[model samples]
Target: MSEVRLYSKADFSECRLTNHPLYSYIQVFFSQELSELVENSTNGTCYALEVGQKLCLVVVAQFQEGQTYPTSLRAQYLDYAQEELALTGIKGKRLLSGAFQLLKRIVPKTIDEVVYVGNYLLSTNLFQPFTTEELQKIEALLQRRFPTKTIVYRSQNSCLNQQLMENLSALNYQSFISRQVFIAHQSQVIQQKKTFKKDRKLAKDTTFNIRTNFDVTNYSERIIELYTQLYISKYSQINPRYTPAFIEAMKTVQNTSFTGVFDEENLIGVTMSWELDGTLTVPILGYDLSYPKESGIYRLLTYYTLLRVNDEQLFHMSSGVGPFKLSRGAEYFPEYIYYKRPASAKERRLSFWLLQKVNTILTRMSNKRAY
Candidate 1:
C-alpha cells in the first residue's frame, strides 16, 4: 500500500499527475489556472499515492455541490424523469426511479457530493487498475477528507478496468451502461482504400483546406463558435460545452492537436484529438451548420483524419458517433459508467434502484436508435 497525501494549493504544482504522459488531460483539467476557472462549480483537489516516498499514482478529484454529473455521461436524467412522471402502474416504477435520479443530479447541500471522477469532457481511460485493498483505502481516505460529502466514484470508459470493475462489484457499487464508442481499425480502413477514393477525390475537388493547431489562439474563438453552432446550440443537453478557456488549456498539453477545416479562410470545422500509445483519438468535433452539406465538407474532414492514421501508421482511429463510425468501417466498443454512493444504506438503495432504471431507459433509447 502507498501513502496517500493531498497537495495544498501552495505546493500543488509538485504533484506529478500534471506531467504524466498517460494522464496529461487529467493534468490540464486539474491545472492551477484551469482549476480556478471551474472553482465556482467544483473544488479541484489533487492527491498523490506514494510508495516509500516515490509517487506511484495520482488522482485529481473535484468536490462538487449542486453540480450535474460530468459531461462524459450522456444519459439525461431530466428527460427520463419527465417521462417517468407521465407513467402509471408497473411502468410508474420508472417515475420513482426518475425521481431518485433527478434528486441525485441536483444534489443539495445536505449530502456533500463528489458526483464524478475522470475526464469530464470526454470518454477517457486514464485510471490504472488498483487492488481491492488499495481501493478500500482510497475510499476511506476520500471519506475522511471530505467527511460531509458522499463520494460517488464515477467512471466512464469504452475499455473496462477489470480490477476496478471487480473491486467496484465486490464493494457493491452500482453499474450502468451509459453509451458506446466507435473504433476504426487502421488496417481495415487502409485495406479498403479503394472505397475511400471517392471521398479523397471529393476532398481534393473542393478548394477547402485542413490545418492542425498546437497554439490554438488564432482560431480558438472560431472553433468555439462552430462547436457552439453544431453541438452546443443543437445538442446542449448531451454535448460537453467546452469554453475558450478549455481550448486555451489545450496549448499546455503536449500530445493534443486541434485540427480545423477551412474554406478560403472561414473555419468550418474543428476536431480535437490526442495521440497516445499509438492510437489517435478524436474527443471533440464540430462544424459550421450553415455550410452546404452538399459540399461534402464533413466527409472530407473524415478522409483527412484517416490520412493522419495512415501517414503515422498508427493502429486505429477511435472516434464517436457510433452509427456513423460503423458505416465508415469503425468497430463499436461498449462504454459503461460505474458509480457508488456509499454514504448510507438509504443512499446506496436509491443509487442501486436509480442505476437499474437508468440502464433500462438508456438501453431502450439505444435500441430504438439502432433499429
Candidate 2:
C-alpha cells in the first residue's frame, strides 16, 4: 500500500512522482502556472494529491465564506432558477426571485468550505480507474486534512463514469445531478442528422476561415477577450473569468488544441478542446456576439468540432442549447456532483441533505417537463 501525499501551491514543485504514467497530465493540470491561473480566475485554491505512484488527482478547495454568488458554486448549481422561471412569465419571476432569496440565505452559507476532488473547472470530468482501497485511502486522507469541509466528486453520466460514481456511492456520498450534458457520436450525427448536414454545408459555404495553425501565445489576449464577451458578458459572469495569462499558458499544455474562426483578418471565434479515451470535450469556446447572426460563425465552429470527432470518437458538448443539440442528433445525460460531509458537522450535513432533496425533486420535474 502506498501513502496519499498532498501538495499545496507552496510545495507543489517538490512532488516526486516523475515516472507516473500521467506525468503530462500533472504538467498541464497540476502545474504551478495553471494553479496560479485558476486561483486568479476563480474563487478556488488548487492543490494536487498523489496516491502512491499510480494516480494523481487535481483538488480544488473553494472557501466562499464571503465570496459573491458569481464566483461561488451557488451560481453554477442554483442560478438556473432565474433562467427557468423566466419562461413562466411575470408572476413566476417574482415568486422564483423570492424563493431564490430564501435559498440564498440558507444554501450558500452552508457550503462555505468545500474540497472538490478531480475538479478541473470544466463542464466534464474524466476519471482513471483505481481500486476501492485506493479510493478509501484518498477519502480518509481528505477527511483528516480538511475535517470541516465537505468533499465533492464531480463527473458526467454513469455511461462514462459508472465505476467511480458507484465507488463514491458505496462510501456514503450523496449524488445529485448538477446539469444535463449533450453528447453526439460523430458518425451517427454525420449520417443521421439532417441539421448536421445543413450545418456542414453552411460551414463549407461560409467565408470565414477556421484556422488551427495560428500561434496561441500571440492570440492570447484576443482569445480571452472573445471568450469574456460571450461567456461572461453575454451569458453569465458566473463563468470562469479567465485572463490572458490563462490563454497564454495553454502553449505549454500539450493535450489541448486551440482553433480560431477568422473572417479574413479578424478573429471572431475561438475553441479549446482536448480528447481522452476517444471522447472529445470542448471546455473553452467563445464567439463574437457582435457578429451578425446570419454570418453563421457559431455554426461553422460547431461543424469544425464535429469534423474532429471521427468514427471512433464521441463528442461531449457540455451543457446548454438543449434543443439545438438534440436537433443535431445529440443525446442528453445528467452530469452529477457527489458529496459527503463529516458526521460531526451536523448543520452542514443537514443543509446538504435538504439541498439534495430539493435538487432531486427539481430534476425530476425538469425531466418530466422535457419529455
Candidate 3:
C-alpha cells in the first residue's frame, strides 16, 4: 500500500503501473509522434503518485511558443456557440475541463512555442482513484500563482472524475475540449478474439490482405487517400477535420506499426499504429464507408494487437466517439483531465491572460470552414 512518488521521468520505469497493461494503453493512444511532442517539450518537474502497484497519478506539462492560426473572416461564431451550448452540460464540461487542464500546465512556459499540456495518466488494474475537487484544487493553485496566462482545464465524461466539470465552473473558470468526441469500449475486447483470428485468415485467403509491418513507400498517398475518405464519410457533413499536412505527417513517425486490409488490391482499410514504452496505439483507421460488413477492420486490428499484447502492453485505440468498439471487448479505462500548474507569480499572471485571449478568439471562430 506504499505510494511511490514519480517526481522525474527517470523514475518512470520503477513506478509500478509502468508495468501494467492499461499503462501501455494510454501511451499507445497518443502515438509516438504525439508522445514525443510531449516528451521533447516536457519540464521534468512533472510529478505523479503511484498507488500500490497498479494505478498512477501522472502530470505532463511543457513550455512552448505561440501558435499560428489562419484567419476566418467569413466564419460565423453565433451558430457555432448555439450548437456548442446546445450540448448537454455533461459533454460541455468534459471537453472544457480536459482542454483547460492542459492549457493551465503549459501556459506560463509556452511563451515561445505553442504547447498543449496536462496530465496524461494510466490507472492500474482495478485501483484507480482521483476526485474532481482534487483536480480543481490543482488548477486553483496554478491560477493563484500565474494570473495573466490563459490556461484551460479539459476532460470529457470521465467516470473517474465525474464531479470535475461542475466543480470547476462553480469556481468561475470556463472549460472546453472544443472540437473533440470520445468513445469507449462498452464490452470486452477478448470476446472478439475468435472473430479477430477469423478476419486475419479472411484477409490473407483472398486479395483481402493485412500486414504487420509498416512499408512506407507508396503508402503515404494511400494513407492520405483513405484517411481523406474517412473524413469525407464520417466528418465532412459536420466539420472539416484533419488537414492534408496532418495526414501526410502520419507516414513520417518512427516505430510506426501500421496494418492495412485490402479488397483485391484496393486498400479498403488501414490502421496507422505506433509502439512505444511497450504500448501500441491506433490513432487513425479508415475503410470504404460503404463496406459496412467489413467493419471487421477494428476486429482485425485488435487481432493484430496480439503481436504486442503478449509483450506486456495494452493496445491504445486512441480517442473517438465511435460505439462499435465497445462491443469488441476492449475495456473502458476512465481518467480525468486535471488542471494543475507550477507555483509561481510570473507564471500565474501570464497563464490567466493567455487563457482569456485564446478562449475569446476560439469562441469567436466558426465551426465550419470552406478551406
Candidate 4:
C-alpha cells in the first residue's frame, strides 16, 4: 500500500499541478493560492497518498467543532426546523422540540464535531483512480487522523465515484439523502415549457440590461442586502449564506463569472457562476423578491442560461431549482451526505438506529397521506 501523508497549510502547494484535463475543477480548489483564499472559511487540512513520488489520491477536509458548523449547514438546519414548526400550534412546536431534544440525547454533545471532506458548501469531492485496497488504506488513515470526530463526504449532481463509494460502504459509512440538484444539458433539444413561453412573452415588454461584468465592490453592500432579503428572509431553508466578504472573495476566484441584471441604473438581480470543463455551475442567484412573479425574472434567467448553453454548445448547465428543472427538460439527481464513525462509538451507533426508526415512521405517515 502507498503511504498516506498529511499536509499542513504550508504543503498544499505540492498537490497543485499543470492540468489533469478531467479534474480541473478539483485542481483549482486544491491549489495553494485558492486554498489560502478560502482558509478563513474552510479551515481545511489536505492529505495525499503517493506511489513512488506520484500523487495517487488526495483528500481535503474541513474541521468543524460545536456551534462551528459551516454557515450554510447551520442556516439550513435552523430554517428547515423552523419552517416545519410553523405549521403546528404552540403545543405542536413544543412537542417537536421535545422530539429534537430526545434525538440530542442519543447523540453525544461532545461529538457534535465533524470533518467535512470536499467543498463544504457545494458538496463536490474528487479522487483519482485507486484500487479498492488503496481506498481502504486511505479510509483507515482518515480514521486514525481524526479519531474523535465524525467524517462526512457529500456527493452532489450524482457524480459518484464507484471505487470510493464501495470503500466507504466497506468501512460501514451511513448515508442520508440531502436534496437534489437540477442539471440541464444538450438543451437545444429541449422543448420550451409553459414558464419559458410565459417568460418569453413578458421579456418583450420588460426591459432589463444583462451584463457580464459590473463593479462588484461598488455594489457589494447592496448585493449582500438583497441576498439576505431573498435567501434568509424568504427562502430560509436554502444551503449557503452569501456574506459580503464571501461574495467579494468569490469574485476573485479564477473560474467564476458575475452577471448582473439591471433596470437602467438599478441592479435588480445577480448571478455568480463557474464555467468549468464544458459545464456551467451557478452557485449564487440573488434578486429583488418584490418584483411580481409575472415580471418573469426567474424564467428569463433560465432562458438566458439556456441561450448561453446553446451558443457555447456546452454539455451541462446546473440550476438551483430542482423541480422546475424537470419542467425545463433537465435531469435531477438526489444529493446525499455520507457519514462514518468508529464502530465502537456509542453515539454514532445509537443515532443510526434512531435514524432508521424515524425513517420508518416518516415513510408510514407519507404512505397514509397518499392513500
Clashing pairs in 2: none
* Displacement of the residue 335 alpha carbon in candidate 1, Å: 2.0
What TM-score, to 2 decimals, does candidate 2 have?
Answer: 0.87
Residue by residue across 125-241, what tens digits does model 1's lDDT show?
Answer: 344455677667666776676654444444434443557777878977666655455556565565476547777778778887877743487777787787778655674433445
Which segments of candidate 4 are over 4 A away from where they belong? 1-6, 18-101, 123-134, 157-167, 189-191, 200-205, 237-239, 275-278, 308-322, 348-350, 359-371
Could you tell me the lDDT of residue 112 within candidate 1?
Answer: 35
Query: Tens digit of lDDT per residue, candidate 3, span 257-319?
Result: 567777666776777665544545565566666677545655565556544554256555543
Taken over the whole model, the C-alpha lDDT of each candidate is 0.55, 0.69, 0.43, 0.54
- C-alpha positional error of residue 325 in candidate 3 after TM-score superposition, expressed in Å: 2.4
Model 4 gets an lDDT of: 0.54
Error of 4 at 183 (Å): 2.5
- Tens digits of per-residue lDDT for model 2, 166-271: 8888888888766677788756556567888888789778888889989888888888888878866776655666667667666555567888999887889999
User: lDDT, candidate 2, residue 63?
Assistant: 47
* Candidate 3 global lDDT: 0.43
Better of 1 and 2 by lDDT: 2
Error of 2 at 213 (Å): 1.1
Which one wins by TM-score: 1 or 2? 2
RMSD of each: 5.5, 3.2, 10.9, 5.6
Please give each candidate's TM-score: 0.73, 0.87, 0.45, 0.71
